[model samples]
Target chain A: MRTEDFLRDITAIRGLSGDEGPVADFVADAFRPYCDEVWVDQMHNVIARKKGGGPKVMFAAHLDEIGLMVVNIEEDGSLRLGQVGGVDPRILPGQRVWVYGKDRLLGIIGAKAPHLLSAEERSKNYQREDLYVDLGLPPQRVREQVQIGDQVQLEHRYTALQNGRVAVKTSDDRACVAMMFEALKQLQNLRHEADLYFVATAQEEVGTRGAITSAFALDPDFAVALDVCHADTPGAPAWRTHKLDSLVASMGPFIHPVLRGKLVEVAKEQNISLQTAVVPRSTFTDADGIGEARAGVPTVLLELPLKNMHTTVETLDSKNLREGGRLLAQFAVAVNEGWEDELWT
Target chain B: MLRDTLQTLLGAYGPTGQEHLVADKVRELLSGHVDSMRTDALGNLIVEKFGAEENAKTIMISAHMDHIGLVVTDIEKEGFLRVHAVGGISPRLVAARKVVFADGTPGIVALEPNTKGKKEPEMSDLFVDIGADSREEAEKLVSIGDVAVYAPDFTALGRHKVASPAMDNRCACALLVELLMYAEGQKNTIVGVFSTQEEVGLRGARVAAYAVEPDIGLALDVTAWGDTPQTKLPAVKLGAGPAVKIMDRSMIASPYVRDKLFEAAQAAGVAVQREVLAFGGTDGGAIQLSRGGVPTGTLSIPCRYVHSANEVIDLRDMEGALKVLLQFIELA
Candidate 1:
């Protein structure tokens, strides 16, 4: 599948943290042709492995996306919201959502209208409890269709921006999953020594659950978790964010230094546009969990610079995704050619 | 006997992101009972008890070995240590509490006196005093990044309850170890994972569950109780047997697994309470969400004053958990 198509298809599917079946199945099907063996693990992590003799390299991208869950149904047929991961309440008011229940139903996150709100209430940050999803049905019918604990995802259409950037609801991670698949496609003809495993992990937004398990199961010599990091915008801190057009290679306590160094080297050798970010403690990615896997797996994070993370309109440069894919493919090939000797040393 | 084991495990120092010593102690205790054992990348001690049937389903019983503690971030000029939380150590709990470093260095955690009348002191206002006169002396005893757990005397309360530090988890670890010794002839291939860094973010259980790849996963951990005055929610009380977890902040217990636990408890004639924690998560949270998802639930030993230095648990609750776990493994 093309990167754009893969992103579009997967992002359209609702894969909230604990509930990620539809998207997992979609990713598994996309991985089947490029991999020697493709299967979904007990956690719904799609593991596609290309068998080889040398060190094992696992590439992970989470399939789960941040959204809302129905915590309660009000008497007025509106649904009370509980976050699936970390759904920002500020962006939720008036946003459209697809409530996954007995059937997918359109709903709008409703809050008190600005005109009716007092100055104090208008100025204060909105809490998740203040927002409710208006499913436009009677209380009895809404209760019948949308039960408590049903998943709700933002309704977004994938659209290309003016300068090669794309906006979607779940670009925080679905873009990375697309890039990993693209990287796998790029490596299909290459004679790499490492056994490459492409894992589409689950429930990363809640916690890096899929990476934790899949890394232990694969027991790869080294792994790279691909995700999207915040991109520099007008008001955001420049030092902490990357440009949307460039790939971000994370360096931190959670990341293995040797793995980070090798990725930097590979990016430079391959002429991939890269930026570096230092995460002192938790990278808040699958890399954190994968790096600390039993005995420890040497792991690094490859981040595609994303704008407006965890919002309905997450934007990212398509070129950065392609570059990240290329970088991952080169890194896998480099590891295949004895990157372990340098890593161990 | 259970009290002795709990005392030893609770007395051990195994902070999040650093649980080797705890794993070592657990490995030593479990070595004789299990057929094979190994520690995984995240320092999860996975020990397997073989079943008589070759194709029996694999069941993973997990308990975190690590606990909430303080990590020294810096040493001040006056020999006081600036520390950060290794897990979710509340500022209120750390103040005026005795703590011990890995090498048995004793210290008192104290908050800077509130001159400005702040309602609650932040963690930054707290420091560990080891009675050292200078930074050199403090450095000689504790290094940067060294972890220290609360030092509390384990005391038996009445006949059935015991109070100690880290009963949130060490009680569960001891329970798993006891199960390994007593739960004979399991039908399933039982993997006991004494996980690490669970207090941090369920780190060890995530990977450990993946490594074990069990058909069923169960976490033996402590749950909060509402026996105290002014308690309203969670309705669980100490001495109410083991609580079968229904949901928490991390993941909801799988209904099938929760039902199966209820069935096992019923079959074994063990009284069990239902747990619906308002906050906090156990290893089962990560295990249930492990690859594609495992049928996972938690057998919670109800405890009072969790995450504090003087956490208390009932011995009968521990026994109830073991009974249900043994029955679940055989019956599932």
Candidate 2:
């Protein structure tokens, strides 16, 4: 599948943390033709495996996105919100959302107008609890349509930006899912010795829950998790972020150093533009949970630099996705050859 | 025997993301009671007990084995060590507390004496004093990334209350261990999961639940009691038996599971209080949402001064919690 097409298909579905059934189904169907077997696990992680006799290798990408859940419906026809993952309350005012209730309803996150606010109220930041979704309907009708715990996704469509960049609501993960599919497509004809498992893990935005279980079940020799990292934008710190056109290889306490070294080696061998992300503790990705699962499987993180992460206007470079997918395929082949011997030492 | 095990677990140095010591102790305790026992990827010790019936519902009960502690981030001059929180240790609790490293190295967490003004100390202003005279001496005793928990000081506070460090969870671990020993001849398959890294976001419970795929999940943990003077919480108090969790920050207990627990407690003639904690989450939060969602609830032993070195729990509440859980398991 084309990167843009895959991103569009995956982002259109609402896959909130702990509620990733639709996206998992979509990924399983997309990966069916390329794999010898495809299935979804109990945690709703979509696994597609290409059988081989050698050591197993897993390429994981989380399919879930950050969103809000309806916690309470007020008498004034507004819905109280609770976050499914980390959300900046400052960015919530004047945003559009789609309430996935009994039926999809268009809503706007209501913020107090500056004209009506007192100077004291205007000076202070708004708390997430203070914000509510305004679904333009009567209180009775709104209650009938929406219930508590209904997922409210940010309403942003995929847009093709200038300079080969694409914008979406959740490029933090669905973009990486696209990259995994691209890697599988690229490796269609390659005769790799290791069994390749492509996993579209669920609930990563919450706590890497899907990766924890799936990694234990598959028991791969080594694994790689693909996700997005902070991109260097106008206001973002340059030292802490990566460029949009390059892939990021993370080195952290959770990530095995040997696996990180091998990923860097593969990037160089494939002539892919790569950046190094130094994370001291947890990478806060699926890699963190996967690396620690059952004894310990060596894990590496492959990141696509993304702009405006965890926001409605997340942007990423298309070229990075292509090159990242290429690097992943090459890494799979390298592991098939003899990456374990190096990994153990 | 139960109190002894609780003391052993609370005294052990098993910080979040590093729970091998606690897991080892739990493994030894559960060795005789369980049909089989194994540790998972996140260091969760899962002990299984098969039921007599062939087609039985699988039940999983979890209590975390990890606790909050300070990790050595950097060594300062004059033998002080800069520390970072492994979980959610408040800066307010770090000043002038005795701590011990994993290798039994004793130290005192100290802050700069307040000559400037009466202001809350930041974590950066606080350091661990290991009686070392210089940086070299401190490095020789404690290396970077070495974790140290509050020194164990299990004390009897009154007739029924007991005080200890890590009692927020070690009490629950002890409860599960006691349940395994007493709750015999269960109809449903029981899996006792001594989960790890719970203080760091319920990491171990998530995977352990997924691997077990239990029909019903119960978390054994401590809940904050609101009986202290001028406290702004609900009317939960120590010695009130086990708290049947209604809701908390992480999850709302399944109504069916909550009702079943109430029924079990009533049948056992044990008093159970309802808990609606305003903050803090337990392993039940992860277990309830695991897989397609297992019906989950928590049995909270009402604790005072939770997440502190001097956490207190009533022994009667612990005994009541065990009785209710045993009745529930036997009826299952």
Top candidate by lDDT: 2
Which candidate number has the best DockQ? 1
- Residue-level lDDT for B61 in candidate 1: 92
TM-score, cand. 2 vs. native: 0.67
Q: Candidate 1 on B1-332: residue-level lDDT in tens?
A: 66677777887788888888888888777767889989888889989998878889888999999889999999999999999998989989889999998889999998898987889888889999999999999999999999899985798899999899888799999999988888677788889999998987899998888778889999988988877887634657788788887667877676567879999999889888766665899999878867546878888899898889899999998888888888888877
Q: Write the per-residue lDDT of candidate 2 for residues A26-143, one digit (tens) a residue.
A: 9999989888999986567899998888889989999988888776677898887877778888889999999998999999999878898889898999888789999889999998
DockQ of 2: 0.07
DockQ of each: 0.15, 0.07
Where does candidate 2 stray beyond 4 Å?
A: A72-77, A101-104, A137-148, A251-265, B1-52, B63-187, B191-216, B220-279, B285-332
RMSD of 2: 8.2
Alpha-carbon shift of residue A31 in model 2 (angstroms): 0.9
